[model samples]
Target: MTHLPPSEFTLAVRHETATLTVMIGGELDYGTSGDLLNEVSQQLTAGQPPPADVRLDFRELTYIDSSGLTALLMIHRRTSALGATLHLDNRPARLERMLHLTDVLDHLTAPPTRAGGWQPEEDDGLTEAGMT
Candidate 1:
């Protein structure tokens, strides 16, 4: 049997006044998804007024399993409870299809966001890219 690399996931958090952006990289599986959970929990608990928007950028996410999906769902629930919205950005085509097939896309994705000439400064909040 071929051996695969040990599961590793990284979450890069950028907290802003109105938005908290998390960029996830590497594999999001059972072994690594908890890091995401804890990070989100800490951020949510620490933000005094709570962020109005929670953006998850999966551009570098190589793979994600059911447990990863569940973790994302948890984030969704927490965001909703705080009266905030969640946005899934830069999703790969296959991953997007899988979310659609699993009927969980609506729970994680926000409406499409617009792109403009401006770029994000270091602390400009969660910058989103187009889904298509």
Candidate 2:
């Protein structure tokens, strides 16, 4: 099935110590993944000792496709190769389900809790639609 190009999305960057956080919004499908990939590449190549950690905030994202998942995997591989950790933060329910069903959640990182609370258990790899 063909998916439409993303109509809207935004990217922002912030730093906390050696960690660089990239906040993403809107659809992350074929048409919009490049923007994310480019942003990551720029940060990695900017000569800043390779960020100790890279966090992707997807709280506002509304959609993601297989291509989008591929883009995220690419980011993971790139960061792993550079010896940096990649953290996924505040994922919306739909996207979280997709990641779990694909059995890739174990490969991704979650945001640290502010109050030093217990870590939530990893997702069971199930989506609300019951597709796995």
Candidate 3:
């Protein structure tokens, strides 16, 4: 059996006002997914107040697997619980396709719901049956 070289991954962080951007490069697979998660967790919980926005800059990212997708979901949950918005920025075609295939693109990018649970959408006195 041929052994494959371990994937090389890198993360760079930047802070701007209430936003924290993590620039990801290289492959994000089973072996490196945890690193990304841990770094984001540390950043999220390291201060008096958490960032209002967390952006995962994927412009430099080259590859990702299921583990990486799972990490994204976990990060989303963390940010949402902290009342922060999560942004998956500059996603490449493959990443976008994976998100769409898994049907999680909406969940990962939607604004966190207000406290007290789900809110009803505004009704302009219109019904699906077409009776206003």
26-104 in candidate 1: lDDT tens per residue? Answer: 8877777777866876787675677778899989898888777877876676666666778989997767877999998
Separately for all candidates shown, the number of backbone clashes (residues 3 or more apart, or on different chains) is: 0, 0, 0
Candidate 3 lDDT, 53-113, residue by residue in tens: 9999999888999888988887787778777889999999989999999999999998876
The reply for model 3, stretches above 4 Å from the true place, is 1-7, 114-132
Clashing pairs in 2: none
Please state the error at residue 122 of candidate 1 in Å: 34
Candidate 1 global CA lDDT score = 0.72
lDDT of 1 at 111: 38
As for candidate 3, its clashing pairs are none
TM-score of each: 0.76, 0.75, 0.80
Candidate 2 residue lDDT tens string, 33-108: 7678768767865765777789999988988888778778766766766667788899999888999999998786
What is the alpha-carbon lDDT of model 2 when measured against the actual structure?
A: 0.72
The TM-score measured for candidate 1 stands at: 0.76
Query: What residue runs in model 2 are displaced by over 4 Å at the alpha carbon?
Result: 1-7, 110-132
Ranking by TM-score: 3, 1, 2
Clashes of 1: 0
